[model samples]
Target: MSFLAKIFRRRPRPKLDLSHPQVVALSARLRALHAMPISSKEEVAAWEVEAEKLRERLYEDYKEVYDSLPHEIEHYLVDVDIRAKDPGYAKYQAEQLVELLSLPEEMPNQSPEPMPLKRHGSS
Candidate 1:
């Protein structure tokens, strides 16, 4: 093979292995975040921030998977961005993540029921 060809050729990306320790840890963190309760806008904002950070870590540590699944990752990120603005939507997103990850519906230390989302102008 020509040197220039080899230099410009794309390399095969590593596959995403869920059994990897780092992936397992990241998944666990995501599940824990999903189970956390948020009562106020402040809490929601904080939750969103942490979730974004986790997403960044996942992308950085698993760049191969991220690159291989651009559509899936972009869809997930967009959904999260849209839903994270409201508590109800955020909870729904979390539930969706749990389902996607195949995590147990009931996590230890998580509340048995979803918290009510307070309406605007309500006390």
Candidate 2:
């Protein structure tokens, strides 16, 4: 590779270390939130607030990872109303967030890359 190419080539970002104390605490908080019972709209509202707070913290502390997250996971982080209305879905979203933070350091494809789409009726 040429000198300029070497300098300009993108480097893979280091993965989020799940074993860090702060990450562990954040994961625990998400699990706790997932386990909470949703008995009423008030509870759901409260849950939404807590989830948003967690999302903000995640984004603030890990901006690179947050920005690189898959679109579905990012959507879950932003869509409070949908999560509030469905407890099961909220749990799933929380799980996804935790998994995101806990991803192994050596895992491949940390960066988003486009995959070829299959054309209809082209088996």
Candidate 3:
């Protein structure tokens, strides 16, 4: 019931410019329509009509680009020389695993008496 709804209700067939604010306004409108209760026939009809309009705008405005994008960044290849490289990373991980595996067997669960470390300068 705001002014934008009035402007949008007019089936003025201009292709939605995603680069402009109208697309954003349409998106907000769609969200509002979606959030409304579905109990009434009137609300359902309005939602359907608006949604079809939006779909047309979206398809007409921008069709080839798919919306669902993977979260990963597709940038430059991983540095082969760095520790992050799969081979190098695996080697580093193996070294850490080896260190962990070769840890001195847990001294039988007896309480550890504090050993006094030899201090060189300060007593």
Candidate 4:
């Protein structure tokens, strides 16, 4: 790989941060525990114990990244104003409901010849 390409390469998003094989297995179990339907108080107690162990392990593994996150810019919001003139095909009056609305002069249809509508009031 070129030096510039290596430097500019994008890093993949972090999923799990634990180092040990047993701890990684425990982490998957912890996630499965959250998804499972537990009925008894004993099950709940066991879940809480597993969760606390996982939490401690994760904090130890990624302490620097976790601590620095609060100081870093966390959220981003961008406001944009979009002004669009209605394309005018969406609605029509009850009196002229029988007649089809012609496409706008700015936008021509696929038809070879567009027959202009004769208004009731206009000449």
TM-score of each: 0.46, 0.47, 0.29, 0.28
* Per-residue C-alpha lDDT of model 1 across residues 84-116, encoded as one tens digit per residue: 446566556544444234444343343334434
lDDT digits (tens) for residues 5-120 of candidate 2: 99899766456655556555655665555555445667667767877777777767656455444445456646656665665665465545645433344224454222222221
Tens digits of per-residue lDDT, candidate 4, 5-118, equal 999996764442233354344434433533332234554455456545545565565454444222111110000000011113211221122111222332233432433423
State candidate 1's TM-score. Answer: 0.46
lDDT for predicted candidate 4 compared with the true structure? 0.34
User: Regarding TM-score, does 1 or 3 come out ahead?
Assistant: 1
Single out the weakest 10-residue window by summed lDDT for candidate 3: 69-78
Off by over 4 Å in 1: 1-16, 68-100, 104-123
Best-to-worst ranking by lDDT: 2, 1, 3, 4
Checking candidate 1 for backbone clashes, the offending pairs are none
Model 2 misplaced stretches (Cα beyond 4 Å): 1-14, 62-73, 84-123
Candidate 4 clashing pairs, residues 3+ apart or interchain: none
TM match of model 3 to true structure: 0.29
CA lDDT, candidate 4, residue 16: 29
User: What order do you get sorting by TM-score, best first?
Assistant: 2, 1, 3, 4
RMSD of each: 8.6, 11.5, 28.5, 24.8
Give the candidate number with the greatest lDDT: 2
